[model samples]
Target: MRNRKLFILLCLLIAVLVIAGCSKTKQTVTQPAETPPAEQTTPPKTDTSTPGSGELKVHFIDVGQADCIFIQLPNAQNLLIDAGNNDDGQAVVDYLSQSGVSQIDYLVGTHPHEDHIGGMDTVFNTFNTGKVYLPKATNNTRTFEDVLKAIKARGLTVTPAKAGVQLVASEGLSAVMLAPNAASYEDLNNYSAVVKVSFGQVSFLFTGDAEEKSEMEMLAGSGAATLKADVLKVGHHGSHTSTSPAFLRAVSPQYAVISAGAGNDYGHPHREILQRLSGIKVYRTDLDGTVVFTTNGQAVNVETR
Candidate 1:
């Protein structure tokens, strides 16, 4: 009887040990593994895949003694300022085509001068133009008439390019008119439209052919404080009649661009103007061919054709 009792106790102890082992194994198998944390990152401001998230390009086309600028905005929009002389129509069109431009969001004539608006009719006829901005000043020349006819054909109305008018006012970009502040002026050049474009920290001033009179008016008005720019399209193609010393002082541009033909008769880019642009870096279409400036809201890179 003692032997049998001892045998039963031994069996019970073994069974208890086996059951504990099985319970521990099941617990170990049911538990989950630990996971690691993910890494963090910051995205860049400029992303080409999204609209308004890219660099800005300003192309100063070589139009020979005339003005024709094409601006590729960060928002994938295009702006054309002047179109050179009438004979330069085809050249301007070809240049725009090669640049992959199908439409012009803004078209500015600046003034009624033949050299400024001469090829405007060609541009209006060729591309799908958005808003046409012209100063209130008008001329009786055939060039001006042709532009009007083209606008009528396209069923597009004119938006006065005058003081305080804002062409674009968006986050990171702004284009405001600062000149032609008055309704009438003695010289036709005073009627030229002056546009100031600000892209983040970089700014550009485009003065078509504004003379001293217009410059003075801008200085005397609310626009004076905003004249400073990184680049200045020298007024009147570097003529002595424009870009007055006071005006230059106010603008305080780091770079100046003069658009004139090589060996032109009018003696553009005059000595007086060169002397005034002493410290500032200068680029001329006659020498640089086509000058391009690309900016990413902070830094600027320049290229010449």
Candidate 2:
């Protein structure tokens, strides 16, 4: 009987050992609970523009003596300064479409002249327009009528092109109208809306066929300071009638761009105007074809096709 009790006690000790071994094995194999991931706070947006792309492209379309400036702002917004002649409407449309332009954030008709606004109607018809800007001066020609009709068709209103008209183009870019300060001018060209565009450390000035009268008025006041720009689109397609010495000195541009047709009877981009821009880097549509300048807010990269 004592032997049997010893066996039973030994069995009980073995069972306890097994229990302890099993508990240790479980503790060794068991893993701690994992923490879940944090929730996102930022809402989703449709902007595909690269935050640090650091480039703004400007396309100077060769419309054969007509003016057309297409700007791709840093914020991915597009701006069309002026359209070419009437026959060049389709060409401008094609160029914009090729450039993958889906919308026009700003449509500016610098003046009521046919060369500046003739193709605007086609642009209005081709792309989704955000806003329209035009000088108060009106013309009785069909080109002007077409633009007005196109704007009406799109159910958009025209904003007066006057001084101090500010535009927030992008996060670091803005444009302001610096001309058409006069309520009325004897010549329509005097009503041209000169725009000054700034981005970071760089700036551009677009003067639309403004002559001495308009320029003098600009110079008489804040024009000296306001006209200064890194680049200047030489006024009146380098016509001798415009781009006076005083205006050039006031602008002090590093680069000058002239859009004029080759072998034109008007003798646009006269030799006298070219001489004035001797110190500035001149890019002409007749010579450079489609001239482009890409800026990284500091340096301008020139590309011509």
Candidate 3:
């Protein structure tokens, strides 16, 4: 009888323990999958301005007695406007090489003037030039012949630039021809290819050797009575016959550069033009060597070498 009672008690204890474990297991709950925090995800940023950022530079070289402006494109291409007088060949070439240029995309001779196109022969022979731009006219001279010979020898083609046509300087920069418009003239100065370069919000006016006639005509054609520019290359090296008061009021450039040789016979940067631009800051190659303007699309800062 004692053995039977002990066995029944042990069985009852085992059943109670099993029932308690099942009850606990049934009450226990599982957690659902967690959602990720919203802040962990972000969109990438895009730059909308200065498409040519970090890749383009424009330089207004100081070649004595003439002008040579170089535009370096982001694509590693080059565009040179004028090459100074014949004597500046070596200097111009050295400058281009120092600036890390090995080839030229375009060479623009505003007109057939010796001062504008003389050193181009050296450039064509030294580097690979894609094309050469000359006015749709010419004033045949030795200087012109030299330029022609260089182009021909290099097997390069000549393209005529006309008013209202646009040329690319860099990815976002554009150069628009503004003068030598349809009306032919006897004066070489009148045939100078005036160009306006626009990059971002700033603009620069490059009037090769345009005189009063070209300025007046350009102003009349705009129909706005005025042309606004952030910087201006003073026409004909700030000659009295160019940059007339009326034209000054029209363009109203904040900064002007005069590319004239020291003690040149022309007596450029005349007092009259200086007086007219008394309110604006002026830079002269005669005083400073090479003048450079750097733009971050919104503003332009100038530096001299």
Candidate 4:
């Protein structure tokens, strides 16, 4: 009887040990594999080439012995100076349209010369205009009367573009009227609204047919110290009466631009004026077509088409 009980107990112990081993194998098979870590990466660097400066473009449109300048300000605003001859109205409008300009933030009629403001009426009719600037000078021609009618239609008032007037005064840009100093003058050209625009290190001087008299007055005025510029729009299409030696000395421009027609009757860009600009680089609408000057407050890049 004792041998039979011992045999039964040994058999039961062997069965229990086998079951425990099987349970351990099942747990090992069901376990998941461990995951690996992800790889690291570096980021790209930022561009800081032109710090705190924006692009500014000044377009000198070719109007054939007439004056028409379109400025694309650093603040994305547009400034239109003059509008060319009476026949150039549609061409001027088309050019502006192609350039993606729908509105003019500032409209300037310089003096009331026919070549300067002949198309002013058309411009007023076409674009949505902001501030209108004009010299106190007036003309009795039909061209000037048409411009007045257009102004009345638009309900826009004229702002006198005279000395001490500030057109733009921002952090990185400044445009101030430096001419039309005297209230009255013997010659109408003396009423030309001369403007000085400075952006960063680059500057431009726009003289609207201003003759020697106007230049002399500006030099004697408070704005004489600010006459220095990187680029100069030669006055009266580089006529001898304009761009006097003293005026050129005060400006000290590195580049000079002349707007005149090819083989025109006026004999524009006179020999004397060309001699005066011998040392400086010269660009002419008559030869170079439309010229464009782009700046970033530090450097200026020029493009001609």
Candidate 5:
């Protein structure tokens, strides 16, 4: 009887243990898993600057008595400021081709004057131009009309080269228009667009034939103090009519570039303007052939032909 009672107790204990194990197993199988938290992140800023990578290079092409500064962006793209005179259009195209410029990201006709927009039509027809910027002023010259016709032919339109407009050149690089602040001007030179091209810490001021009237307005504008740059493309080709002392003082550039023809009639880089630019390093297109400044954003290396 004692053996039978012991056997029965053992069987009952074994049944209870098995039931408890099954209940625990079922509970564990039915339990829901805990979810993980979502991660936080911010989208990076968009760099809309046209294709470019590597060092930035600015080439002040030797166009006699005219202006045509070709900027090679860090992204390997090109931006032409002006294309010299009408006769120099083919030269600009050939130069670009030799420099491996397959396309022009930006083309700027600072003013409607022939000296600025003369070769613009040829450039527009020769290479694919991305965007063109022109000031509000009009000269009604054949050169200006040619540019307009070319733009229309390319199914493109000109964007007003006004203050505050920005040119996205590349990542960490850009340019902003800083002049032609007024609505009207009697002199076409005063209507020239002044653009400040900056990459990293280095900056360049390209004043397209802007005279005292424009300079005064620029000084009176909001970005007056921001005109400071490492390089200044002297206005009116370093003529007595422009590059006023006040303008020079404000810009305080380390180097000044004057674009003029050798033995030109206007006597560009006039004695008075040269006197004003005494302390600043001056490079004339007539003397330097083609002046090139290459920058790795912070510092620059200048080379001239």
Candidate 6:
């Protein structure tokens, strides 16, 4: 009887030891398997917080010899300022399609100049324009006529854009029209629809061919307002008449984008202006192709195509 009891006790001890060993092995195998999934999940969380990754974007298309600026609001709203020259109409259309832009929320023609308003005809015919802003001026050019006809055909109204007017572009973007006041100047460049767009901690100034005359007025009017910007679209393709030293000093942009043709006849992006913009990062579409400015309301990054 004593031997039988001892045998039963030994058997019980062996069973407990086997079960404990199995439990330890299972924990060791399962722990390593569970750890990798946790590590894998951490990367995506880090990626989302990266700067410029989740921010709004602005694309300055290289429509040689003219200007076409596409602003993508944080909410995905679209704003187009001038569509290059007539030759760029089809290219602009193709670009918008590729970028998934089916409609334009706000379309602004800086002036009646062909290079500024010509490609707009194609844009108007192709997409739905919510509001149309144009300089309060007229030109009898066929290109301007075509743009007008398209706007009328679409039943869109032409509104004059002026300073002090503010509108919401997206959740974070605010648009302020800053040119074409009642006080007239002899030059059409003075009438160009200048715009100052602001978002959290960042601001951009778009001078649509506005020359020294308009820049002076803007600076004088905004005395002490501090129009410093993160980005500046070089006025009049960096022409000598635009981007005056005083104006550049007032705005003090961090980066400047020059939209000019390769070997343009007008001598765009004059060397003097380039020199005056010393210490500022410059991107020229003629050399770098399309320039894309992207920001997450904190910092802006430039990418060339």
Instruction: Report the number of the highest-lDDT candidate.
Output: 1
TM-score of every model versus the real structure: 0.84, 0.85, 0.79, 0.83, 0.82, 0.81
Q: Write the per-residue lDDT of candidate 5 for residues 1-305, one digit (tens) a residue.
A: 99999999999999999999999888876663322222112222244443556678999999999999999978676788999999999998999999888889898888888888888899999899998999888877788888899999999888998777788756678888888898788999888888898888898999999998888888889444788899999999989999887888999999999999999999998999999999988999998899999998899889998
List candidate 1 stretches off by more than 4 Å: 1-48
lDDT of 1 by residue, 1-305 (tens): 99999999999999999999999887876663221222112233234346653788999999999999999999889989999999999899999999898999999999999999999998989999999999998898898999999999999999998989899899989988898999998788889989998999999999999999999889988455699899999999999999999999999999999999999998999999999999999999999999999999999999999
With a 3 Å backbone cut-off (N, CA, C), the pairs that clash in candidate 6 are none
Minimal lDDT window, size 10, model 6: 47-56
Q: Give the per-residue lDDT of model 6 (tens digit) for 1-305.
A: 99999999999999999999999999999999999988898999887765333456888999999999998877667889999999899999899989889889989898888888889999998998898998778777899889989999999999887777565655566888877665566887888988888878888889999998888888887642546788999999999999988889888889999999999999999999989988999999999999998887887888999
Better candidate number, 4 or 5, judged by lDDT: 4
lDDT of 2 by residue, 1-305 (tens): 99999999999999999999999887766633221222222223433444534577888899998899998888778889999999999999999999888899988899999999999999999899997899999899989999999999999999998777886656668888888789999989888888888888888998888888888888886559888999998888999988999999999999999999998888999999999999899999999999998898899888999
Write one digit per residue (lDDT tens) for candidate 3, span 90-163.
78999999987788987888888888888999999899988778887776698889889999999988877767
| Candidate 2 displacement at residue 239 in angstroms | 0.6
Lowest lDDT block of 10, candidate 2:
33-42
Colliding residue pairs in candidate 5: 52-74, 52-75, 53-74, 53-75, 65-261
Which one wins by TM-score: 1 or 3?
1
Q: Give one digit per residue, the lDDT tens place, for model 4 in 117-213.
A: 9988989999999999999987888999999899999999999989989999999798889989899888888899988889999999999999999
**Deviation in angstroms for 255 in model 6?**
0.2
Give the Å shift of residue 228 in candidate 5.
Answer: 0.4
**Clashing pairs counted in every model:** 1, 0, 0, 0, 5, 0
Determine which window of 10 residues in candidate 3 has minimal summed lDDT. 29-38
Q: Give every collision pair in model 4.
A: none
How does each model score on lDDT? 0.91, 0.88, 0.80, 0.90, 0.87, 0.86
Candidate 5 deviant stretches above 4 angstroms? 1-51, 169-171
> Local error of candidate 1 at 239, Å?
0.4
